[model samples]
Target: MIAEPEPGTTAEPEPEPDPEPGTVRPGGRTARVRTAVLRVAGDVLAEQGFAQLDLADVARRAGVGKTTVYRRWGSVTGLVADLLGDMAEQSLPRTETGSVLGDLRANAALVCRTLADPRQGALFRAVIAAAACDARTAEALRRFYEVRVAEWAPCVEQGVARGELPVGTDAGEVVRAVSAPLYYALLTSGVAPDAAAGERAAAAAVAAARGGVFVG
Candidate 1:
């Protein structure tokens, strides 16, 4: 027979319970793996550009199995598309200030901050370059902008509802107008927009909206 522990000794602690399957908890192993892979992908895109992106290199950097990477994302374009989707999902929600101008300014400021970030700026540049040559990348890029615009368009709609802007103002167009100059500055002059530029862009959109320029 096995001997019992001493009277004064404590018994070993029981093992922790396992979580239910098909129920993904945040910060779990699966989430960690995804986080690691995406981080490595972003790093590579920022440092080497899209031209140098390879699944093998990404798997090596992520410390994940090549098979896993291939199974999860079949091709380079697929990986990039998933990355954009993740970015859209994780992006901050639109701010709802009392006034449409305030909301637009908040949106403009968010765009300016993202474009001014070093890694983000480089990543976007790489993606844009890739999009110029790859149809899949172009479509993914288009979807990303569409998501962002849809998120902010409600603010313009609210402006019209509140009588701040003319009736029938095109919400999507106004939202796009606020971001157009900022992106233009980045793509053309290679200048990341500053807070002042963001404010100017917001103000210009508001002016145009009030002038019924975006009326449908």
Candidate 2:
């Protein structure tokens, strides 16, 4: 877990500029190594939090050489960025329910389930905490949400096309609105949002959208 900085404790300075690492896609043994390292990294983040995630520790757990882990990922932040990228890539596609409300409900359900899951919930909390102190992790989190929002934004667009929503509705904002409350409940209360909460979130977002609240 992320602990707040003690009084007089200074934050870590940002690292020097370097090429973004861990964005490469390789096949064969390279792919296997990447998968194993990432799996171990995620396990560490979920179980022990970001403070305990060390490249050498991950290398040992993954049965890979420390040199390889260092060479490929370079730093903890790089590995985390790669891990988040992988998660976004592997996430389930948006469901098409033939209506904006239905689709947004589906999206809300997915978010609820993910945040409610034991490992996934812990993992998200850890990453979110890490993002608070680390610029790279924060950027990775932003990119992750961007990818997710883009995936579901089409539902709102479809709703507008079908005249179910107002013209000029911001699709991305609508998508973000659906999941905002669920995340807030999770972060603030340390409680996973239930299905009923998801239902309410979906309904509220739909109501707001229909009211032209998301229009711009």
Candidate 3:
């Protein structure tokens, strides 16, 4: 592990100077640092698992300052939590393809694409393990899902407005429906889930809704 720098001392080499206000720094170092941190965090979680995650190690791997990590995220859990939130936010918004099935396929496809990345998948596994044993991690994971579900729920709401779904259907539950099977496959099968799998999950979820599986 790298030693923590003394307070008020340099941790990494400084850029020559900041750019003028409101002007883009061509080949931005700030963007590089952000990407570097995220890349390092993902790599460490994939290679070392959650229990072995430390801000110092992340800094060392990122070639960034430990102080910056601490200042930004405070702890490994916090860092991972923020990363998950960012990933959720960056994900494409639900497509309003006019039918619940169409919207659901979009949702499922995006999720499949994300979990298909080995590093992202391993990080997810580590987080899932932590969530199983640690309350903080569990809460963070739940919140991450909540954010994602909410982001996609509007499509369900649109379905309701268009009378595609029943009047009493819960939008959040509808959005989560698109994910349940994909998650099951991730946690159980070793198979690479494809767009067809997403279509199956979407069809099943919409079918369940038709059968009152999601009704209160």
Candidate 4:
């Protein structure tokens, strides 16, 4: 038989579940909550930009309690940070195409496709806009790129190992180079880069890598 609690003493409540990403913990209910909340948050950001993001609104759309959102995320910046972290965790892994040029082409194609995606492109613009004036959001955006760059950097390193790329090439720089022009065009001209642009970006980066511009 289990012993009863002493008089005037209270039993401990169940522990809260963990968050999906970032600083939050993860568990059954917690994961579900995070999924719902982040979905709504992304929708809001994509639809109305960061200016329209509100914890109460997200909670309403997510069917979660406002208190829960506030208590868990603390602020809009916190939610965005966690959302970016989740995105990084969920992003596709790098491709290995045996050749540096082929691998970079694959990478560039992925970036172009993402930028061409209406919802994804809008979400990225919103996040980038928020980062312009928000230090926390800016930091989170940097971290997101860091995670993505690290994921693909190994492809460049493998190319160097195979003698396809120059020795001492900066793998991260090469990886970023493949995507930079695509992002720049999208942000500057509001143009969704096509497959041709992807190919061009990859070719340019490969040429630069061969020319040892990425060497460090």
Candidate 5:
């Protein structure tokens, strides 16, 4: 008879096989792994910026297999793209408050809150910086803002429909105007905007819209 294996001498378990890229379903092990990996990726981006992000480091930090990360994301730019996609997917829908000013104020408040959060602010700065040099990341960042701007454009359109604003007002431009100054402040001053600044942004956008500045 063969001798039994010695205690504490069991063979190491095999590493899990990499899942087919884009074939993993949601709300199971795959979802959990994605969530964990993205969270770690965001943390790294927030703390160390994009130049320092590495798939192997992210996998190790996330407690995921390096092969899995490599197979799924393929590169730093790919991972960053997925991270931006996830952020766009998870952003809150626009709030409706029955008036253009109220809705715009709500949008401004949300933008301010996001930028004011230390981790989130840093993450955005890092991503924006990365976008300046990486084409894939730049496209991803553009898509993220496109998603956000689209979500808020309805507010301006509704205001025009209600005759509160001039006809032919460019809804997308009006919506973008509200956040432009807030973002400018942050980027220029390295300071998160406060609530008062949000109010000013909303009011300024509304005033501009009312003045037909955004009319095409």
Candidate 6:
């Protein structure tokens, strides 16, 4: 028999080979990785609250290596920032519905749908909670809203140019008006922002725009 290796001195066994390619689902490898991170991060935030989040845990649960996670997103805050950006880009673009009221309705409906999503709702709440104490989180949250508002502002500007809204309408405020109350309702009365609430918000926003409440 060959000489036995010294105790604890045998060449370390080579690591097992990684799982085969077919073992991986490729439908959205990138998206899957992103979803995993967000879900894990959101879970951590909800269960232990934001203060206790650990990037290592998130990476482990996401089935991604910590080195990969760190290489892509230097910190938890950075990951959260990218998550928000992904969400913003994935959201529907504002459409031209001819009338300010119609556009507002469509916008309000979209907001309601998004905020009512269990995942989105929880993620948003966690982000808001994080924003309360973290400046970076707060700035990220604000930037997310700004990007969203900018996506819809063109509708208000279009209305103004068509004489549907006052010439000097503040497109930003008009867009903000469409969803602000719905957000308030959801946050305050614990109400589900239903069709009626959305309609009301849209109508209010349209009325404000027509009445020049958004006039600069």
C-alpha lDDT values of all predictions: 0.87, 0.91, 0.78, 0.89, 0.91, 0.77
lDDT of 5 by residue, 158-178 (tens): 999999999999999999999
Separately for all candidates shown, the number of backbone clashes (residues 3 or more apart, or on different chains) is 0, 0, 0, 5, 0, 0
Q: Please provide, for model 6 over 1-216, each residue's C-alpha lDDT reduced to its tens digit, 9 standing for 90 to 100.
A: 112235888433332344464475555554566677877886776566667777877887777656656766778888778777767767789977898788889999998987788767666767877888888888888888999999999988888888898898899898898889988887786655998889999998888778878786
lDDT of 2: 0.91
The residue ranges of model 4 lying beyond 4 angstroms of the native Cα positions read 1-27
Worst window of 10 by summed lDDT in candidate 1: 10-19
TM-score of 2: 0.88
TM-score, structure 5 vs. true: 0.89
Task: Please give, for residues 1-216, the per-residue lDDT of candidate 2 as tens digits.
Answer: 212245787542232233345644576456777899999999999999999999988988887767677887999999999999999999999999999999999999999999989889999999999999999999999999999999999999999999999999999999999999999999999999999999999999999999999998
Candidate 3, residues 1-216: lDDT per residue as tens digits?
324467798755543354464574545765566567877887888888898888987878887777666776788888888777767767677787888778888898887887787877778878888889888778888988998898888887787778777777888997787887787788787554788888888888888876767767
Error of 1 at 121 (Å): 1.0
Model 1 stretches astray by more than 4 angstroms: 1-25
Q: Which ten residues in a row have the lowest lDDT in candidate 2?
A: 11-20
Model 6: which ten-residue window has the lowest total lDDT?
Answer: 10-19
| lDDT string, candidate 1, 64-86, tens digits | 66666677678899889878888
Instruction: Report each candidate's C-alpha RMSD, comma-separated, in the order given.
Output: 9.3, 9.2, 5.0, 6.6, 5.5, 8.0
Clashing residue pairs found in predicted model 2: none
